[model samples]
Target: MKKSVNKTITIRDIALSCQVSPSTVSNILSGKRQVNSAAGKKVLAYAEKIGYQKIHQQRFKKAIHLILFRKHKLILCDTPVFSALVTALDNCCKAQGYALSLSYIDALTLGEKATQKTISQIISDPTTPILLLATEMSEQDFHLFENAKAPIMVIGNLLPKVPFNIIDTDNFEAGRIAVQHLIDKGHTHIGIISSSVPFDSAKKRKQGALYALQEHDFPIKAEDILYLSPFAEETSDNMTQVIQNRKEQFPTAFFAINDYLALGAMHALIQHGFSIPKDISLIGMDNMPFDCLVSPKLSTIEAPIEETARQAVLRLIALTQETEQYIMKSYMGVKLVERDSVLDLNTCK
Candidate 1:
């Protein structure tokens, strides 16, 4: 009788079984390089089935990965809000002895395969925590992160019914406060400047504003709601046409979904001979730095970007330390920042 030999399963064995290169298996397991999602999944499944053990690499310091997922560049840019959030996250991570790394994934241009590949690489190391800046990510885009092994947290957006850690501003409350402020100022007819891109945050804000309008018995008119392009230039052009055509019946006040849109609307109004506060009071969300620089400083609802970042980092760190974890969802409060743009109609008369 010949003695049977038991050999440890290796990367080469898994690669040959899965019909892929050893380097491919190594990259997928080590997360040193990006691998195709399909191939990676297959390789991972096979390795798990065969009980293949991979030698873990030692690292000197812990790391946190921040992935900014944008469906379109027009909506998510290097604006004050983006800069502030990133800086805050970096600071928080450094304070906790974790090195922060950032990655931007454009889903529209990369398509599903490439995006998934990049995401897989980021989540390959289960030891590293991930923070997804999902401001422009759709509900469908979330499916990719569903199977992530890393402790993941989403920022600047809310995902209902999806189990994940999230920290976002109370966009609904922000919208409600903006519109309510306008209403309290004696503005009867109000208009909304919404984006053509259907972002979850924008949708929630619009819904909240609508709720406030309905609560106050204000008539909701389809024509009053203007859907503008995400780009500032395009938004201005679109608003210009709307203002020209509706000059006779334009609303007294407009609640722009964001500060950029508000500035675009302001430009159109100014060019068309309409005065801010005097002719049309305007309010916006996201108290971006530029809001204060513009003539007739914009009144906006502060989005709590820094607070959201801090909370997200804290929760993600907690998740990484836990033996048992639960899906956590948090909404930071938003407040109205008064400025010169919105007129107090009650004081007018």
Candidate 2:
């Protein structure tokens, strides 16, 4: 037998070898459409064996990139709600026949050079769409996406001024519902334990709380509201000092911006010899897992974390496929998850 030299195998050659149409092979390679898993595997394996170089040149070739734009160390992995969103995004990507790549844009310390580098890599390939986990992103942080080529969608509680597609929970409504629950319990005097963090969700929650107070004709006392540091230990210490200092003016009930802050306030109040829902009533938002694990199960507002993630991914896909145009600002609803943490003031007397 005579020796034969290897020739360059084109997509048509691969398609012919796999006994599938060239379009099917191209679709499989580009991740443009879902093909039979066995057929896809066969094509991929054969292409790899023949040393496919075209696919290697592509960036984000057949995947969705999840960029976590955070200003703090507590990125998506640190918080349970964010974790749920990530999980949902992963599942959604898998279902859509796309691989998901995760990257972090630490806007907290993002310099010009680094920002340009990240933007370059993102726009390097127009086929790969970007799904931004921008829940914590500010208006300035969103400017990074101004020159991006790939389709982008944001998942968070608030939308930035830039008109990109966004899917977020209705934090304002969550705040309103939380405070209304306390009001329904006949707590005319209520406090909101908040932090100085510049989170949109936190701000909306505060606005909602104030709205509820105004609706019920309850006096909004500056003395009743307590502001603490964002850090857990600092929050705990500040809450303790505030509670002790304002003991005489303490409100009958307290609503925390989130479960963590709520937990901090609860611990401090208890340390100051005030029992939860006994000497003081408490409620929180975020429906964090700790809410259920605590000594007194915490009542909280459930943020639509997973649903927002799923919707964001779906919207991103739609954008990439050109099935939808015009940026959309979508809001997911929130619900009150009542547990043992709240006290019905009517029953107390």
Candidate 3:
């Protein structure tokens, strides 16, 4: 430690040795200017030999709390995807010497307080960062973020258009590819069942599906896309109607927005007297945990949840290193998983 200070060289030393102002030497350290190519290189080499570190205030605070703000809606987080994402994010946070805390926004049953806590309540400190797993942010939520002055990075499509970085999956491409795969398989009539509403991901996936149909010259009428209640009980009517209305139209293939949607549609298809693959081939997204165990395994799109989580953690960490408003974003890739649910045209009518 004494040697570090003993040999300690200041920018002043370099400026004097190089016959330049201290500011010129400082600029060289910050890499701000090209101070005469040869002369700049000399100052940089001297600085490195002396070992100088730009001491900014102490590193940003420690742990960042990840607040998942959905009080009334509980989605299972036990699957491999969710598990992997959570684990990766946790691991990244730990490795960075940061603590990760998870709190359910709705669990407090904070009601209006829940909303208030989300937007207005942020632990104030310049030391660390806050990683908000707010996959879906509404207009009100935007106002919440707008009012805060914390280091924040959201996990999904941002609502308020705040400059905090966002890390999300490419839902649109996932949807487009799922539909494109079905089209390539020689299925002309394709159907879609959207699991939820106003979910930017859900909407983008639907748009991708439409893009596939449009590209393939297939019909995509308003009735063709079904936006049903995501809850099981509320899905019965809409799923039944979709299966009934499209059966004869030979809507031989369908794309469920997610594994759960496919599962529900599978139930409805069975109740409506249709056999998987034989009567209707299906492809879903998220490749949910049980997709392969069903009567006919489901073919679906895989999401890089762990990678998504890891990226989110990394971006948030990077955000803490600066105060500039920038767009830090990343999208993981998607691939098709072939399973028993798809009917091969060579053997099927």
TM-score of each: 0.82, 0.79, 0.74
All candidates' lDDT scores? 0.82, 0.77, 0.69
Q: Model 3 reaches what TM-score against the true structure? A: 0.74
- Which pairs in model 2 have colliding backbones? none
Candidate topping TM-score: 1
Q: Tell me the tens digit of each residue's lDDT in model 3 across 264-316.
A: 88888888888988888889898777887888989999987767777777777
Error of 1 at 215 (Å): 0.7
lDDT, model 2, position 35 = 52
Clashes of each: 0, 0, 5
Runs in model 1 with CA error above 4 Å?
Answer: 1-60
Question: After superposition, which runs of candidate 2 have C-alpha atoms over 4 Å from their true positions?
Answer: 1-61, 74-77
Alpha-carbon error at 90 in model 2, in Å?
0.7
Q: What is candidate 3's local distance difference test score?
A: 0.69
Q: Residue by residue across 170-273, what tens digits does model 1's lDDT show?
A: 88988899999999999989989999888888998999899899999999799999999988778899988887788458899999999989999999999989
The CA-based lDDT of model 1 is what?
0.82
Best by lDDT: 1
lDDT of 2: 0.77
lDDT of 2 by residue, 1-349 (tens): 9899866455557877998655455556655445568888899888888776444444224688777666765433455665556656766676667766667666558777786686677767787888877767777767768777888887774565777888888889988999999999989999888876667878888999999999988988888777877786677898887866764768888999888889888888888888888878888988887788887899999977767777888889889878557889988999999999888978867
